[model samples]
Target: MLWFILIPVLVILLILLISCICIVPQATAYVVEWLGVYQATWPAGLKFKVPFLMRVAKKVSLKEQVVDFKPQPVITRDNVTMQIDTVVFFQVTDAKLFTYGVERPMAAIENLTATTLRNIIGDMELDHTLTSRDIINTKITAILDQATDKWGIKVNRVEVKNIIPPAEIQDAMEKQMKAERQRRESILRAEGEKRSAILVAEGEKESAILRADAVREQRIREAQGEAQAIMEVQTALADSIKLLNEAAPTDKVLAIKSLEALAKVADGKATKLIIPSDMQNLAGMVASIKEMVTDDSAKK
Candidate 1:
């Protein structure tokens, strides 16, 4: 009878021992409360609780989490309306403050992100906002890091997902881009035409200059040839006249030359002939008649 009662007591003690101690997964932490009051946080692996007095209030995940804030309509300094969507990457650094400092860290972060984004975009014009998105992201991160310092939420990174302009504004932007592209194309075509025209003109100018130089060289060569020809003919005529003037009247050299000339004029075939009526005409006729008479005497 005493052994049976002792076994029941031992079983109760074993159940209490196993129930108080809990095994938490790695990268996870649990908030523990003692007698309905906040006590301490339990880390990964094995931890002990005060049996029924202490309870696991909440299980807090310590890993990095991404929170996307709701789209906030922000007006730029230039009064352009746009919808901004943002995503914040964060992690819990201190479990105690993360659980106790803020009731809803995600909501708080979203609200803070919206407000900061609005403030940042509000200070920039529409054109500046599109261009300086990185600057705005940095500013948001700076503000969030400072604001969430006490909450034990580390803002790892802040990114602006999309900045949506209105429908009419988007159409206007597209038209403007298309117009700019067309203007650039027109300018490029005009520049190409201008270059082509310049090259063609340069080629024509070079061709004309080459033709002019060739003509000048040809005319100079022709003039030189004509002058040389005239000089040679005049030299031959002067030599013939000197030979005739130097000949002796009784030398018979002129008579022999005259006979040779007359023989050449009547040699081979001479169906019809004309002689100039000048001072040498009668002498030529006399030489011809003498050559014929001399030939007849030689034959006899």
Candidate 2:
């Protein structure tokens, strides 16, 4: 009977001892309540609790968490209706406050986010709302961070996931975009044609310049050739005159050469010839040459 009693008591004590041991995992916190009231928060690692007196109330995760809310209907200042969805990033900073600060923390946060979004949207026009996502996000994060301080929640960031305008507005926006694209295309085509025309004009101008240069060069070459021919003729005439002087020609021989030149000039189609003032003297010399020739022929 004693052995049975001891074994039952020992088993009961062992069960109680095992129940007192609390091992909290990393990035976790356990909110403890002493006799149904707030007591202490247990961090990660080994912990001991008073048997049957302290109870684990709430387990709070210290890691950052993401919550995506459904799209909420909002009205812009312009009276345009739109649906906007949001995602909130948060982290539990104080385990005790997270457990006891708010009745339903997640529901509270969702409701707060919807209300904040509506207020922000109500102050902005549809166009402004659509274009100002960053401004909206910053404003909401600031408000939520301030509001949720007591709940031991740190609002890390808020994102406006989607903003949907009405179907009619969407259709109008699409048409506007299409028209803008067409205008840009027309402008680009005109610019391309303008550039092409400019290139053609430049090419023609360059071709004209090259042709002018070639013609000018040909004329210069022809003039140079004519000048060289004239110089060569003058040089030959000078050499002939020098040779004649070296040979020491008599006046009769010179007069015979001049008469021969005059006869050649008279053979041309000219109607008249200008005779030199010394022509009479030249005629007398020529007659003398003719007599010498006749005498030489007789002597031979």
Candidate 3:
């Protein structure tokens, strides 16, 4: 009778022990509850639980999670409506808070994200909201982190997935951008042309200066040559005058030279040789003197 009762009690205890020992998966934690109230959160690996009184109420994943938000239409401060979509990357930093702090942490996080986006977009113009995406993402992350910190949630990052403007607004923006690019191109071309003109003008000015210098140098050399020629002529004229002054003023040399000049004129290859009127008297006197000398020699 004792053996039968003992075996039944041992089997019941073994079943209860099996149920109490729980194997939690890696990167996962379980929330324990006693009497349907929050008790404790068990980390991953082997854990124990009260067979029926205390059970694993919930299993909270500690791994990182990605939540993508649907597109939400927001009105900008400039009265333009924009459709924006975003994604939030987060992880359960505190398993205890994740299980009890909020009713649905994912839903709460998504709602907070949408509200924050609307608030941020509402303060800015549509153009700013669309263009400054990085700035908007940073702002959202900062605000979300601060807000969720009390709930033991850490917001890793927030990203603006897309900012879609209305069709008409998109068309207008494209046209405006095209016009701006064209204007910039025109300004750049004009600037390049202006620089080229300035360079050409400067080159011309430098060439003109060089040409003037060359001409001046040429004129200076030409003037130097002319002055040298004039000096040579003046020097020759002075030397001739000096020789004439040094010559003997005697009648013999003059008479000899006069005879020589007369003979050269008489033998000249010309039909007529005109003498100066003043030399006519010298010629007659010379003839008379030569005739007397001839007569005296004949008498001797």
TM-score of model 2 relative to the true fold?
0.75
How many backbone overlaps does candidate 2 show? Answer: 0
Clashes of each: 0, 0, 0
Model 2 agreement with the true structure over 1-300: per-residue lDDT tens digits: 899999999999999999999999999999999999999999999999998899999999999999999999999999999999999999999999888899999999999999999999999999999999999999999999999999999999999999999999999999999999999999999999999999999999999999999999999999999999999999999999999999999877787788788899899889999888887786798798898789889999
Report the Cα lDDT for residue 296, model 1. Answer: 83
Best by the TM-score measure = 2
Global lDDT of each model? 0.87, 0.95, 0.87
Q: Give the per-residue lDDT digits (tens) of candidate 3, residues 174-225.
A: 9999999999999999999999999999999999999999999999999999
All-Cα superposition RMSD per candidate: 8.2, 4.7, 9.5
What ranges in model 1 sit over 4 Å off?
1-14, 184-300
Candidate 2 C-alpha RMSD relative to the actual structure: 4.7
> If the candidates were sorted by their lDDT against the true structure, best first, what order would they fall in?
2, 1, 3
Q: Model 1: clashing residue pairs?
A: none
